[model samples]
Target: MRLPLLLAAVGTAAIASIAPLSANPEVELAAEDMLAPYYAKLERELDLPVAPAGAGLAEDTVLTRIGVGSCNHQSRSQHMWAKIAAADPQLFLFIGDNNYGDNGWEGDAALGSLRAAYAKQAETPELATFRKAVPMMAAWDDHDYGFNDAGASFTPRRWSETLFETFWGSTEEVRSRPGIYDSRIVGEEGRRTQIILLDTRFFRSDLEAMPYSETRPPLGPYVPSTDPDKTMLGEQQWKWLEAELAKPANFRIVASSIQVLTDAHDYEAWENLPLERAKLYRLLAGREESGLVLLSGDRHAGGIYTDTPDETGGEQLWELTSSSLNLAFNNTASNTAREPDPKRLTDFISEENFGLVDIDWAGRTFTMTLRGNQGEERVSRTVSW
Candidate 1:
């Protein structure tokens, strides 16, 4: 199987250098003899400072600027943090692929890799300063969740959840759940904004791979799974989402680790489970009273998509996706898996990028922008509610 370039780069070096406590005699003996002190040092360095309490933004505070991005390789330079900080967002949302742990090995090796990745991220001066300056929330995609394109079947999911909670300091209510899906209401009363972080990886069923055909052009290896029984969020999360939508919030931002609006992309996305996508649309349609916007990551390239009013109950539903804070698919020629989305408002940007959402309460308008590492705006769309 072809590995992601980042995974390939880390490859054996990670195994040799960061193997955790293992039962395999060779690994175990090596850990005890040579890696123990290294692990100890990493543990000390990984100690992230505690963020001030509360649900990030104050309920009474006006919601304005927000920063979002994903697919950051832990070992790589996170030069975007400075630009992201410069954007002056009140909150930062890390949608997924937060770290390229790619811990497929069994037992303690997975734990060790996760620790090492988190340690690298925590040690980054820019990242540490950003964390101190901005209140942040996160959701994990495949890499940080312990495997590539992993889902409910990933055996180490619970262990991954444990690590994620500890490193991110997730709330007790979120930690109590089998999955990391959580929702928080920020802002207050008439200006309240609900941020629903979806756990797409935990309950998602296995995706269907496309069949090879001699007559058809190979779009990619995946096709929509027509299985009505399959789900992206499990039944419990679905119920919780319904309840969240019913809450009286002026606007709601649903954070998915993968693109929800771009169905033509033949990658890991909501398109793989058409029924679930339909369900999400239906949910939004049913709750037109609550203004809804989608946020996502995972795709290295970033763009903004808007569904027609007909599809969203006379209101255009917008999805802003930002990805690869430190990594980008510069070779666009080789990445032709995505079909052009009619709803796309901006050119897809394949560079080290992040997204900014600026809400104007006085004008009752919002502008979303995809910006490069240096804070240069690549594309932006301003729309009124």
Candidate 2:
């Protein structure tokens, strides 16, 4: 069987030195033992430190418009920022993969090349201009978290957390925590909007991939885990999430870096952690009137889906999946698997796109739009909750 690149990243002698811990991940290593050579490599390579971005969004102000997008390749054209800026979004969520710097290695100085990718993104003038006009919040997925499809066992994660917090301007409360899971309740009472950012990587258990020798799964590369002992959010984050949900808010936006509702595919998602997905459903079970919505990125394609009252056992939950701000997977070369989601209400948008959420407080309704940089609205759905 061909080993995945993540496993190959540790093929060098530097990583071999930590094989007692790396080879047997469950033993776990201290942050000090795994951090030095790893972070030192990135520091030596960065053109300059990645400065913090977009702070001081007022909680008393009303937020009527919101935007979200992910899966950005730092090297690609960032023209989408102009379109996002034009929309006058009160808040923009940078959900993940904001910096693509994975060079398939993590244990030693291999991260220098990855640091350069982040430096390139920070220097993008379009993003700089957008940050000036828009107050942004961010959460990282696999790539920007330092490697593609990585989790807790990834040696450099502690250092990766520091880099993420520095670039995105994470809150002091977030910095004090281990994982980036946090909640922000902005806007005044009645018009309050709660943003729940999940850190699916920092404390997550490693994923179990489907063998390459076996037929590739129809959608992506991974197998579902039935082991309930395995966790996606870890104990502390789960406790944090339950408490965050308890705080009352007019509308709640749960931002996950990976898809949550679609189950047909074997790709990295809440589906892989079945019990955890159920727990989320149970948490939102009675929030039918909360104007709850789910936002996710990571899939190269974009689409809209729903978890009806019957499906989730509470309210009508809609999930808007927008991705690949520049990296479109429409071409067959990207992948051959067809995403088969029976619950999807809109056609899969396989082109470059972003998601827009417009709220009409008077009507108690919200609209989710999937559009391209040219203002092409490929799919849209408005829900009255």
Best by lDDT: 2
Candidate 1 lDDT, 194-222, residue by residue in tens:
78899998778778876777766444567
User: What is residue 51's positional error in candidate 1, in angstroms?
Assistant: 9.1
Kindly give the number of clashing pairs for every candidate. 1, 0
C-alpha local distance difference test of each model: 0.76, 0.77
Model 2 regions more than 4 Å off:
1-26, 31-48, 52-55, 104-110, 212-215, 286-289, 309-311, 331-337
Best by TM-score: 2
Candidate 2 lDDT over 141-161, as tens digits, reads 988887678877776676777
Query: For model 1, what is the C-alpha lDDT against the true structure?
Result: 0.76
